[model samples]
Target: MTTGIVLIILSAALLHATWNTIVKTAGDRTSTLGLVALGHVIPGLVMVTVLPFPSVESWPYLIASTVIHFGYFYMLGQAYKHGDLSVVYPIARGIVPALVSLWAMLFVGEILPAQAWYGIALIAVAIQISSWAALRHGVGRAALFFALGTGFCISGYSLVDGVGVRLSGDTLSYWAWHSVLHIFIVGFIALRRGNAIRALPRRTWMIGILGGIVSMTAYGLVLYAKNFAPLGAVSALRETSVIFAALIGFVFLGEGNWRRRLLAAVLMAGGVALIGLSI
Candidate 1:
């Protein structure tokens, strides 16, 4: 990947961590999650109106991606409810790089360089290290299960969008449609918890929507970079968000051991450097 693409993906990583932090801090996670989905929907509605529709060929992947996101959002909310952001975020994002690499190789026929694979392995290790304390002490079976489920959903959507964006002819249009389709996720949450959602404070709504905007921007950046880079490399680099999440949890949420998190960050940075150099 080029320097520009690396920087773009890194920026996305930061934004990704930021939004997750927003969700982690929220009092009503499910309602905040719905607002986050609405965040995507609001911009998506305007963008779809103005942007060209994604190609017909990409529709299947688009729909599939939206479906996967439902599981992702659900698992993420559940995981947060059961564990700290520091614990849940790392586990949830930790497994995605390898899973996306494997899926890309098996299904998409995308082979990454050996060095990139090593970098990916290093990142995977770093992710686990970031969560070592939680792992040792136990983050609860429910948290572990939900976090793993979230990781699976993330990998699924990553591969689908990586190929889908390439075929869509226009990355922004594909993203716009994908964002608009988040309406289903938002609607589902609303239907199940309409009374609760309706009762959330205005401040909560604003923060959640803002978080959604950040999340949408992060997704757009990753999709744009996917158009230019290998899936495995992009994903390995993107999973650096776990490091960012660790820092956020420590600094903002007052969670986790900062010393261990620092070590993980250094290791992840080395992995990132390897991936950047290999590409």
Candidate 2:
């Protein structure tokens, strides 16, 4: 990976973890989704005035991505409701790289080096270990299954966004429109339930908005990075945000079962290194 992509990935790692922690710790589904949509709303609405219009060809990709992201949101909200952050977050994010690697290999006309393959295997192991840490802490089978379902949704949309951005030729507009659609879908759901708008605390709103900004920007960066880098590498680096979230949970949320988590982190870092080195 180039220095620029590396920095973008690393920076996105922090932002990804930060926003996930904010949602897991302070924000409920309504708060999290609302803030996330708001994050896109502010930046996306402003970009409408500041940036030139995207090609008309980009519309289909934008619209498809929006639908996929809404599903992602629904699965994620349910995952958060049912599982621990360490378990849900890693498994959900972890599924993205594997499926994306397979998609890139089969469809994107990209070939992975042998070392990158090794990295993919390492990533597989890291995901297992990270998941084991959650189960070791007593996360049950049902919660684990829900987290896997959520991970599948994440990987599905991530693949969509990865191809969508590169082919669309306008990452910002793709994300911007996707965010707009998210606001409509998530907002509609919240309105129907009458949960988010009426009773959410002010602090949750603040956390949601901040988390949204961090999250939207992270998505933008990853989509932009995939324009020039390998999908597997982009996905791997993004998953390091799991480590960041783990640390955030430990420090801020006072989670202390560190031995197994440390092992998972090492495996994850090694996997990322192997992938990056293959580049």
Candidate 3:
């Protein structure tokens, strides 16, 4: 990937970490997630009015992505309920790079370089290092299961969107539609907890919506970058969000041992460097 694309993806990673922090600190994860979905829907509604529709061929992937995202959100909320952000975030995102790489190779026919593979392996290792505390102390079994499920959902959508956006003819339009589709998530949450959602504090609504916007922007950037880079490489680099998440958890959420997380972050940085240089 070019320097420009690398920078874009990294920016997305930071934004992603920001939003997850927002969710982690929320009073009600399900409602907050619903509002986050609404955040996407509002902007998406406006954009779709002006943007071209994604190509017909991309619709199936888009639908699949939307379905998978529901599971992603559910898994993420459940994981956070059971574990710390530092623990849940790394395990959830860390597994994505390898899974995306494998899916891209098997289904998308994208073969990455040896260096890229090594970088991905390094990143995977660094991610495990970041979560060593959880392993030692034994994170809740529920947290581990839900986080793994979240990882699988992320991998599924990442591959789907990577290919879908490429075929859509316009990245922005594809993203706009994808954002709009999040309405289903919002609706699902509202249906399950209509009274609770209606009773949430204004501050919670504001924060959740803001987080949704951040999440939307982050995903959009990744989708755009996918148009220009290999899926595996882009995903490996994007998993840098785990480093950002670890720092956020330590500095803001007061979650873990900073020194160990920092070491993992440094190793991840090395992995990112290798992936960047490979292209």
Best by lDDT: 1
Candidate 1's TM-score reads 0.95
lDDT (tens digit, per residue) of candidate 2 on 1-279: 777887798688888888777767663565566666787777778776766566677677677777776776677777767876666766777777777777778877777888887887776677657557565677666666777777776666767777777766567777776666666765665676555555877777777777788888888888888887888778877877877777677767778567756886888778878877778
lDDT minimum window of 10 residues, candidate 3 = 130-139
Residue 112, model 1: Cα distance from true site in angstroms: 1.1
What digit string (tens of lDDT, one per residue) describes model 3 on residues 1-279?
A: 788999999999899889877877877777888998999999999999998888999999999999999889889878888887667877888889999999999998999899999999888888888778876777788999998999999999999999999999899999999999999989989999889999998888888898999999999999999999989889988888877887888888787898989898889888988999998
lDDT of 2 at 127: 60
lDDT string, candidate 1, 145-215, tens digits: 99899999999999999999999999999999999999999899999989999999998889999999999
- Assess candidate 3 and give its lDDT: 0.89
Each model's backbone clash number: 0, 0, 0
Displacement of residue 114 (Cα, Å) in model 2 is: 1.9
Clash pairs detected, candidate 2? none
Show model 3 residue runs off by greater than 4 Å. 80-85
Q: What is the lDDT of residue 252 in candidate 2?
A: 75
For candidate 1, give the lDDT of residue 50.
88
Better of 2 and 3 by lDDT: 3
Clashing pairs in 1: none
